[model samples]
Target: MVSQTSHVYRYRVDAEDTIVAVDEWWLAFAKENNSLDLDEASVVGKSLWSFIADHATQKLYKEIHRFVRVTGNPITVPFRCDSPTLRRYMQLTITRHDKQHLDYESVLLRAVPSRRLALLDPIQQRSAAFLTMCSFCKRSLIEPSGWLEIENIAIKLRLYREQTVPEIRYTVCPDCEDHFGSNRQKLESSSEQPPR
Candidate 1:
């Protein structure tokens, strides 16, 4: 028997076991269970396998063998492509048995988003604001606090003129704030003075 270990987990297969064929069977099994989305199917299947691999009983193994025997058909799961060129179109197929002994036809596949994504239906547009750096200080748009400050600054700038007192006071380090305040005072004084 061939056995493999991943971290704390151990997996064993019979000497004649076909890993590739088993993968195909699982893929087909997922489709039978109405899990057409490959990513979701994979996630669920992997979780299930991890559980089974760790604590699989003889009964559970026999049940799985029965499932494969009854289905007798190739299964396919759809997967969305992360690639820009084929971003939304792809699928993966799995069969019950080895390819060489092909009892069933090749599994058919088509891309479909996961059920979770379908439920949420998030906007597909990318946010330019998230991609760009902060406009005022060239700081990267990283960290939750930085993002919050950026949002606050944008809102404040839009609602008030340059001289208007800020409604929402921003907290900066005392040293930095003092230096900035001094620079502002110098600029104002320079503007007020008459040309020499």
Candidate 2:
């Protein structure tokens, strides 16, 4: 039998690596129920999921999502689906925000590195993926690598909405074009320098 302290230690290590925050209520519940049995790890594992489903507050659920995103690791547990088994288990639940309330009906349970739902159309995705720019002209150019012109392209590109392109015209203000041209020259010169 796994001692309660041992179980908690193991759980803390595992959860720390993946989950961002641990729920105090859930931790207390586990400690009280003596669900820390290694021999009956399977039962305890399933019970944990049930406990979360029944008792998890909205804040706790949101914390779990934040944890997964920051850590990039999946939650695990100790149960098998088909026959009945014991090892260790992982469980996760995600809720989407509705206009006024959280929609829990679409909860999902799986390993980590979960996929974010697609919020942009195909054109938007493609444009976002490939669009670059000419600093002088402010033209959006589809390039093989990624967006150019910006010092930190990936970070800056994230600021723009995929569906909305910045207004760049032939009649752009002369001063703005001059500023862009200077930036372009700097970037070009930097690229020409050999790696340090």
Clashes of each: 1, 9
Candidate 2: where is the Cα deviation over 4 Å?
Answer: 1-8, 12-41, 44-47, 53-59, 71-196
| Number of the top-ranking candidate, with TM-score as the measure | 1
Give lDDT tens digits, candidate 2, residues 90-190: 32233323222221111112222212212112222342233333322233333454334332342445523444433322222244344445434443454
Off by over 4 Å in 1: 1-68, 84-88, 98-196
Candidate 1 lands at a TM-score of 0.21
Q: lDDT tens string, model 1, 1-196?
A: 0011011111223212322223444444444434456433344324233432322222323333333333434333232222111113333333344323222222223323321221111223322232322222222233454443333433433411222222221223333234345434443444344432
lDDT by candidate, in order shown: 0.30, 0.30
